[model samples]
Target: MAAEPAMQMPSLEELQHWTWVFGQAQQMMLEQGLDMMAHMPGPAAMSHLFEPAAAFRATADFWSDTMTLWSRFLTQEPGAPLGEDAEQARDRRFRAPQWHEQPLFDFLRQSYLVIAEHMLKGVDALEGVDARHKEQLRFATRGFLDAMSPANFPATNPEVLEKIVETKGESLLKGLQHMLNDMARGQLTQTDPDAFEVGRNLATTPGKVVRRTPLYELIQYTPTTPDVLKMPVVIFPPWINRYYILDLTPEKSFIRWAVAQGATVFVVSWKSADASMKDVTWDDYVEGGQIDAIDTVRDLLGVESVHAVGYCVAGTTLAATLAVLAARGQADKVKSATFLTAQVDFSHAGDLSNFVDDEQLALIRSLSSDGYLDGRYMAATFNLLRGRDLIWSYVTNNYLLGKDYAPFELLYWNSDVTNLPAKWHLAYLTDLYRDNRMVEPGALSIGDTPIDLSSVKTPSYIQAGREDHIAPPESVWKLTEHFHGPMRFLLAGSGHIAGVVNPPSSGKYQYWTNGRRVKSLQTFLKGARETKGSWWPDWIAWLRGQDGQTVPAKGERIPGKGKLKSLCDAPGTYVRMR
Candidate 1:
């Protein structure tokens, strides 16, 4: 091997300058170390150090401004606070308070994590690093703390002072973080080579084919025991997310619950998108994806109609599909409709609306110019909106104090990426969020026919979470007003994901409905029947009212039946790239 050129040595002047600077850094560390010790509060007062009282005061000020703005937009009488009158009427309501008017401490726990952040930065700056280098160091340190999943920050070993004031502190933090990364890497390798693989496999697994519909290729849940129902209940999951959120785990899996109910269940797993799918539109999903499923089920099961359940975005799409069918007087195909935390109106939408302005839309459009919206970008936006929980919580725990990452499969699953076809997203954002057009009859055309929500006379059950920030209670309630059909709106006990996945065995989750309108859903459920087991059984009973007794066998389908087969397989290709 060739010898490298000899490096020039530093002059005595440069060496002397660095030596003096290093000494000054050591002096500063000694001073700050003394200051930290002297100012450190006793155990009784220690909690205040991490409380960040100033930050809380700042938060209170911000929310005060926000509440004033939001209060004006409530649909009730101008004087009363939003949702309060509705709550007053509810017999079994929590009187869920809006903390915007309250002190910040009421909303967030005093995070000692903030103390860890302050200590890390203060020590790094005292070490004589340049401002830029110090910032980098700060971030790296924060990431380490975030990974650790520490219980609380000020509570960490006071001994961190001993390590940080010396060169040894830097090495200790770095070494511990490195070990943690190695362990997480190994654990991840066992479960999934990459995050997307977990869902990809679940989606693609072959089983008994319940129905081969044009709108989808579905996976049927095979029960471990004897069969009950002949015609299957086919689920239409929104294309926005992967299908397996329903089959999250053996314990809480909705499919597992359904199988236990002795009903044959099938779920539509959408094909992942690629450049070729850029031209696929909302119409394609309905006409191509959903319409085909109706026909496919008719052929495969010999059943006249199948019970259709749509989740979130899928529920909206399903509602529109029913409208088209109803317009054509073809409502006989779907027995009854069930919506899980789904939205039908954008009126009085939540803060997520702030994310859908022209500039952001343009940025997304530019991205789709390449064929697909990078799912990672979409995920980042949603994650940032809850930064204190999703981003900062992780940052403080993993990067700052050098801790091991927790094995949270749900979080891991959420991080897995999936792509959105450019055409589909563009239409959805413009039509749903921007125009709020879906509520109007014939505002959107499905094929040659006009889609109308009021025309949807299908018996319907809609569920929403009281605490869901994604689709607020008002947003979900918009469905009942628009459908002009027999409707039951249930306000579940938790947030977005929990409301939908709630199993009855988890205890009584309240739902609401009567022949007449109640002041609020929470109030209505108070008077409604209390049931055991999952709500799925209640839904099954509703659908059974509309379904035929005889189970049909497989027959034939249109030419497009095989067109979607090429798109099959798990994580399907669209979810992997991001």
Candidate 2:
């Protein structure tokens, strides 16, 4: 028998063109079918056409206003600006040269805006479909309109056209090369990689690896104060990214700031997973990872209790660990719990939850045959949630205008991704995102014990980002109901990472707190008082009150002094791995 012929693969450009062609065809079919149904001569047809009729009316009104603005501009009469509300335009890249100023470009931009609005309204007006389907439809519709925006094309984009004219087409050639390089790498080039070195410039806060585990390394930051608080702090950051996000540069380092405030700080730096660690489960993380870190901190400080902090997914894990400890009659292990933008209830998890249905979950499992979900895949999903900012803006800058990516610390941290273990990822999706079992009593288990958040009863401090897309403030507020102990909830004015990493020295954003618990999130917000500063100072003050009493500082305590011996320097061996 003859050998089988080799299969051919489509280029990225070819794939994109084909996708657009298919979308156009589907849109045409839908429009034609709707038109046919509208013309049918029967009462049932008219009844069935109510939503489409409303959508048509709305579209007509939108276009009528658009035409009136154009007519005024052509006749040289004073008229309202086409794109007057800059805040409504979510994509910043459209603010490039002459897009809002030039008549022709402004008209194009406004036309796209009107169409997008109509599309969203049409999705909302659909009567028969369930909420989940409607959400999916809205998401897909927005993605299509975003792709069709004139600003994405070099020929139609004013800024890209000007760049070509200025550089005599050399910029376009460079941009093409950049686009090709990014396509080959399977990710957008978000920052200039040559500008940063991890240890020297990025994760530079001084510290040492006090202990190492199969899953993580415990880093004890060098104390910066003369006398430290008796209670130490152990932070568990989400393992999806490196722990350096909390230690990114001295000015913004949370660990450094906490140490300076007279607190001994330790952070768990998780290992990037590979096939060898595929069998690790949620139980292993709670018991062997977080609980073990608590034990190490107690031994190192010669104290019984320590303050426990967790960010994002790690926050959920920390809550589960606390419940497990409480079940074992070790409730005093954690003196207090702090959660940053963490969600105990996943019912209202924002746009991220739209991609977590049964079909998508199965697809993810099939793709994780290597025993881990690839970091690139996770990054792509997040970028899609804010495609205009995280995806296409980079596209226009790197591929159309031929501009080098600026060196940004936050973007760099975002690009420094880590693989998640396949087993743990699946369990997290099924238990938390899909079933939302974390908030329910005895629905989730760790080791041999079923975890229950209501039984934990540790005093808690929770912070939620006002603009967080991953874990919305409404979802975070649900934690108040689950925790039986005293709770202080804060609403910070930024997105997920920025809200948590905010330093008081910056004097940038504001936070809100009512100092009184309420049953509803909206009610809490309505009664909350706006304070002009970062929430970090408030947190530090609260922590100080909980610290019991002051003690003599262990100046630059070496890692090898504790029962858990030193494995390496700060940032450890696992963080150094790819």
Candidate 3:
């Protein structure tokens, strides 16, 4: 047989685009697909049976490459690259020099890549399946392929093998201990969990809890500047996680940064839901969460209106609440709005679209034995989204290499999970994810008010992460059409958390912006120019543009001297909930 021509490979750019949740999602889709397939008796299952010829050809190619790698390894020169350097692979798993310098490890690494690439290409060739299930099968297959990589196990991983020998088997014992500790915690350890805590070192921004409701508590941060903007700012973070992410640490805290920039900041601290809070509906989150926070800010400060900000899930609900306010003739309550990596349209929702279907939603609903869905489960699901980074990487560090995870403020906050009330969770999944009703005006409502997104005329500063897994830039761009206000659509570097939380001091990443609206993200990119560093300063400048009136900072450091009596210190009681 003649030697074959080189296989056409996906560019590193193409591969990097899928990096967000590709590794973890690949596993998540497969595990969930099995159960979902049982209930989803549809043509998607038959998609696998389609394109059999291509699949067979790819399989043969995979085997051929594997055999070639094996044969080459049998007689290869020492310190020589085995066809390709695994170290050069874009994948972090194969970055170890041992993977490239050692022939056997290099073979294992290349063989795995060959298999994964072929499998992914074969999935792309699949036909006859609906687009949705086709994607599901693709991710599921990738998950399986990713999980079986030689680098995941100590025995097959040269780096891990070296660590074992260096420590004379003590590494193995420590790995078992780490595994046991994680087991006791009932979740995989991503960082040193004990190293940080809310208020003590994490959410240490000085502030006061001004308002508390059954659903949420509003924290009003003390001003770092003598005079604060007349229009105060209220932030509603996703109920799926705590609000402290915005206030992680002084240097990194967006909340702290905003206050120092002469803006009074109030953040919604959602009380983690429990069985007692099961009946809380999505409307409650709107009325009691964002709306209530807005109302509280106005009441506490004696201001007519304030600037509003929403993040992720809260951003979606913030838009929905704006729609409701529009319907109720109270849109003026919010002077302006800013959305951080938020979506108004789901049409372009990337890999996440696979998880929401009739069967899967029902299956998820069934898992909530209590009135609320455990935040831990949602956390795990999210971890699976970036499984290679959030899950497997830790497995290698804490278990395989028997090394301690560095004390990271962000990872600690990421580890903290919050539950979702059953009603709100189901409604969000069904109305938003399954049906994408947010884009369809009047298709959804809060309480009695119809959620007519077109009626939302509040000016918006919408910022999206170019690489956000939760809110793709395309989906966030769709938000421009939904709001009638003059909008600024910003495309920032990095993903959800890092992009929005980026502070000016650290000086990482960049952002793209265009004054004029474009037909699509691709078109927008053509007209946009990249500005290096954080989007925070641009956002602050915009905040100043909206009602730039300044007043002496209202709430003083004295406990009883402020206009509104302090309820508690910042990182309030609600966020402290498990």
Candidate 4:
């Protein structure tokens, strides 16, 4: 059989041209249809015009609001003077003295052409149209006007305009300096691949890796290697991001540390859901994903039970999976469950609540009716949550300073997002965020069983980050009360990702663990032991206690036929898909 040709995508310029052509075609069709309608005496065409006009006006107002948003952001900062050390440091590192022009020029050139093209069509549509269709054309015209308005385009803002005038020639020097620095540092991210090599060594010893599991394939880590672990640990990473984050580098990789300590580790690398996987839902994720993974590990390793660790949204799904397991009396398969900055409750979720309200949710529902939450939309929402850090800060650094943006590998990795199945996203928002249903005993049902976290009796480890805005300390720590387990609530010092990936080697990080069996987080932090160094050592020690002693011989080793077959090559799709 002959190989079919590969698919091709158009360049950005081609895409822009096609976009203009499509808009023009739509406008022509609407005009012809309107002319036909005017000739007729029905109200349907008139009604159509009204809805389109209203939508246009709404969009116009939206851009108008956006034009003013930056000013609001600037004012919102306390005293509006960059005095804080963190902010100052960021400015010094990113800001180039008197750098601003190319971006502003580029913005102006692009916006003018796009706005002019669309505005002209809108104007022609409205000019000699019957008064009956005027309202509809008015909206389309208004949108064009909004786009073309000086206030909305280019370096017209006082700060931006002034920067252009003041920092013309000096920016060239600064740009050159930055380029030299980046080149000296070995590319832009300063990523040391040596770190990966070191971590790989720490994780895989000589004659230890008997079989490597293929990426995105289900498999078990067994006793084939002499360095086999006693505690069977399976890590479920959030499909929203890459799984390798847990094992970013040698100094930072959590998986490497666990291996060194003799703990069997299994990690699920979720496939990036595409058009084919659109119909997948929250239930599918649990049953076909994490649950399937759990069963695979159990049967392959021949273990009575296994320990499961969930990160972020993965943690939320894990909680739901446990509820399903307990309801069906399959909870016996789980030895213990750990949640890392995971939320089962979302009643008072901070700023994110602002976006998940009725109007936005409705917009999402309408846009994602095709069964996949567009990854771009998800990225935009996350960008908004930390607008200062993700949006404006970069704008100031990149646009204001005529500096070429050097890619940070971490940020680059983060920008590479995976699609969320539309069904799963809607269910997640409605059931978990909008309704706060997961924590409720019977609000959620998996198959025929209702999930009751209180019924979950497995030993649990709940880690909440002190600085996690997405999953606040209070919101995440609340999971302890829901789980009727011998639980340990540890407060890590870093944000969501850093908190869990922490290896005691990183200096200045801390975590709190109360020696006494505390009832909840509020009480536990009161007299908790403030430990220094990495939380990795602490987690390892905790697992050591839970893990059975490592046996030296085959006779003493746990008897289990490793039945799980390798599905793909090592360093699977889960970690590198994005």
Candidate 5:
């Protein structure tokens, strides 16, 4: 390892501010919230949407600024402050002495930012295009700017050069080794892959696989306490990824926390879809997936109903299943519903919406020749969304800095790839993103039943991450408008995953709450009260209030009366399939 850079680093306050900047962008960039739309729009990815005149103006201004910064580079000192954006101080990428103390590198940094800012402004100034097209352009432009940062290139990056010199070329050698290792694995090394394992440290929650269906396997977690909530809790995790995200390490696991709180928890572990499952439709997910999950929980527990929870796309399906059931006059099957960053209404579906038009649809079909759209494509799109962090940061760290990434259970779960069934994924994009049909009265038909969200009478708790890029909080907010129920909408302090999976024990981010239904999301945020710590407690308290009854835990783990038996352990075969 090379010695630390001689230049002083930014203060803690400045670092925190940069984190804020990144947050707004993750909150800006990319699962996405649902599989409906996360990839870049074909048109946006191919070219810029800026007007020719605006482009010229932006380039001329950027050129002037670049020349000005270059000429004055020698006059600046490492300690000299970049004006008070407060955000730039926090970038974290250019921390070495050369980046600040040296003139050329600092000029490179400022020049990139100058042109990037102007380019975005030009996109904003674009005319003759709809707002959706404009947003797509802005997002694509941001990705390009993030990729073009001087810090990403070894030749241009001062920190990497310093590392090579300090380590006498050992850093470059080690970087080649790391890059080659990641190449062989077919994924970026964001964390030490050896640090975490599924059943060993990650999803170690004690439980049994109570039921197995073609689409998923239902795992009921063992309760830590002797007594448990009368209503068993069933979770529907997004099929786009593994269920273990909610069941991470015991310390951070939302499932473990709920079980410890005297609630029985069951999660749907989706199978990594393959060509055999390519024909599977969204209706299967609604009926065969979530419906099957809840039915197993109710039947195996010998109960009539249970509290239902869903994350990401699963939440979308859960809501649809509820609507379908409610229309069929079986609304009581799910006593209450909790949605974690799920968007049922897609009208304002952020940057991802541009990825759902006819052109993109044709492209997806071509890729789905094997019955599934490779999940890696979606993961890649998400990486592009947060390229500065997920993509470039790792490239700089693993392949340039000659340093191994720290073990992050979240990133591990993220890298544990899962594929999507072509039928279900396509239906999601077409019906939801392209057509905006989920919220329509009878437009969506799951299991031959017309889906009507208004008919869903179950009490609901809707949670959205404030800076969620994958499922923009604003898109999640639209669900509050469509779902007819006694609803509680909350805005958590971080982006999608961090916001939702945040454990109360960390005492990290805060959550905002507005019990009253407001007309606009902005209004909700305005009148909302902010509370420090995780929103897990608030959700649990709300869950308990739905029904204060209890049940004996002694034999509840013994799912099914006599015929049904445990197929496997929790975090079952399906999750480990691929």
Candidate 6:
């Protein structure tokens, strides 16, 4: 048979040109449609014909306020100061120092603000649309406005113009190369490629992989203290990211810190899912992944019970495992539980819930029909959620200004994403995201047992990031009500990764604790006492209180020395898969 010719990939410039052309076509079509609409009765007039008078009045009032703001801004004297809130607004697009100094830039910025406000109000005023559709429309409109901002274009952006003159066009050339590199990779570059090496500068903490499965590896970190707690600690980090995030550097490693605090720490390093693992599902993860890890920990330590910690999605999985165990009459195997930025209740999963509609899920399923959700696609979704900071800022800095990204460890880990098996991804979206079934009694089942969070009687220490969007603080706080035993919830001062990876030595962020359980998140925040420093110390103290008495440390041994045999070294073969 004759060989089929290989498909040719488009050049970066060709791709960019096509994208520009398509965008221009869409813009023209939209403008023409709006122009046609203008010839007919206007939206306000049409609303009066079909909608309630009160709705029309509200729309008119919004436009009136918008016009008043615009009039004040346009008629203001040249060089007059902006309002305090506008000056202090955290929107980075308008943060160019020149915007405040240059009257033209200031006008453009304020004009964009007014337009965005009106666009959102217009979306809200659409009468026939449901609340969910209205929200999606508003979100889409905001994204469009953000993308069309003058700050993203060299001709309109004062900062880019300044850079062009300063660098004599060299900046633009360098930026083009950076953009091309990102294009080839099919995503935006989040950090400098030359910043850190996996086995050297990052994920360098010493440990040994004591057990291995097709899905994951159990890394038993060497104990640092002369003596350790009688009970061991095992951590289940989310599989979406490499396990090294918990052991990024000796200075900031949560694993290292826990080991140093006289606890035998173990972590699960999930293998990057590929075509070979297409059949892997939530049942496989709970039974084959986490349950196996727990059994291995018990066998290795020769202990009846161990302290378990879960982060993010892994936390969700761990909670389910505990419930499953309780159902099986084996709940005593786990001494206590610690959940970090993990949510069992997906009812209020923050802005991420906005992207979980039926259409989006269908699209994702179609894309991943080959049996895995590509890691790059997942990263892009997350980047889009925080587009201004994660996408456009990089476009402006790396492409417009032609500067290399700074060496950031967290970003490096974030960029190293792992693919998710198709079955597991679909199940997660359907059961947890679409249905919010994890917290509902008997709605979720792993194997033959139905999972229920309320049945898990383990005392839990739950920590939530105040700014977490993936798992909102309120959603995480809801766990206090589900667990049957004592619970302590701590609110940290940063977003997801920052909140979880904070080290006491950094002394950069703070945490809050009311030292009492409260059902309402707002009430908890109102009564919580703010404490400056990492939440690690407070967590370690809490863990110590829950853990058993100290005993002389055992000498380190390879996996083969124990019942669970060896697979590879600490950071593990699975973590290094991709």
Q: Pick the candidate with the highest lDDT.
A: 2
Report the poorest 10 consecutive residues by lDDT, candidate 5: 29-38
Ranking by lDDT: 2, 5, 3, 6, 4, 1
Q: What's the lDDT for residue 13 in model 3? A: 61
Residue-wise lDDT of candidate 2 within 286-341, one digit each (tens)? 98899999997887778899999999999999989889989999999999999999
Q: Rank the candidates by TM-score, best first.
A: 3, 2, 5, 6, 4, 1
lDDT of 5 by residue, 1-578 (tens): 99886766556575456445433433232212111122334444323444567657765665565445644653443434322146766787767767775655666666556656666666677666677766776776777777867798898898888789889999989989999998897778788889999999999998888788888888877777888898989988888889999989988999999999999888888999998897899878887887777776777778889999989888888889999899889899999999999988888776677577787789889999999988888887678778888999989988988996799999999898899998888888998888888888998787568988888879999999988987899999888788778899999999889998889899999999987779888999889999999999999999999997987886755443224677877778999987
In model 1, the worst 10-residue window by lDDT is 103-112
Distance (Å) between predicted and true CA of 52, model 5? Answer: 7.1
Candidate 4, 454-498: lDDT as tens digits: 888778888988888788888887887788878888898977766
User: lDDT at 184 for candidate 1?
Assistant: 74
lDDT (10s digit) by residue, model 3, range 191-236: 8877898888889988888777888887877777878888888898
Task: For model 3, state the Cα shift of residue 120 in Å.
Answer: 0.8
Task: Tell me the RMSD of model 2 versus the true structure.
Answer: 9.2
lDDT of 6 by residue, 1-578 (tens): 99876535446565456445433543453343323322323223433222466445644654564445344444555433332255337677777787765645665565455445545555565676556555655566666666766688887789889889888999999999999998898878878878887878888877778877789888887777788988888899998889888888779888888887888888889989888888999988899988888888887778888899999999999899999999999998898889999988887787777788777788888878778888887888887777778888888889988887898888888899899998888789888987998888998799899998889889788999989978989899878878888888899999898998999999979999997666788989899999998999998788888865877776443234566566666677787776
The TM-score, computed over Cα atoms with residue i paired to residue i, of candidate 3 is 0.90
Model 5 scores a TM of 0.89
Rate residue 94 of model 4 by lDDT.
23
Error of 1 at 546 (Å): 3.9
Q: Backbone clash tally for model 6?
A: 0
The lDDT for every candidate, in the order shown, is 0.58, 0.81, 0.79, 0.61, 0.80, 0.78
TM-scores, each model vs. reference = 0.64, 0.89, 0.90, 0.65, 0.89, 0.87
Per-residue lDDT over 1-578 for candidate 1, one digit per residue giving the tens place of the 0 to 100 score: 99866645446575456445433543453345335433433223222332355435534543453344233322211333322234223412112232222222111111222233344634343333444334433443444444332222322323233335544567357645654763674221112224434543333333344333333455655444343466567788877667777776556567777766656566776765668788888888887887677666656555677778888888888988999889888898887788988887986566566566577688899888767787767667666555446665444345444444565545665565567888888788889977899988778888889988888888888887777877888788888878877777766666777767776666645544444566565556567655433566666666566553532222112111322222343323333433
Candidate 4: C-alpha RMSD to true structure equals: 14.6
Give candidate 4 misplaced runs (Cα > 4 Å): 1-216, 219-225, 517-520, 551-561, 574-578
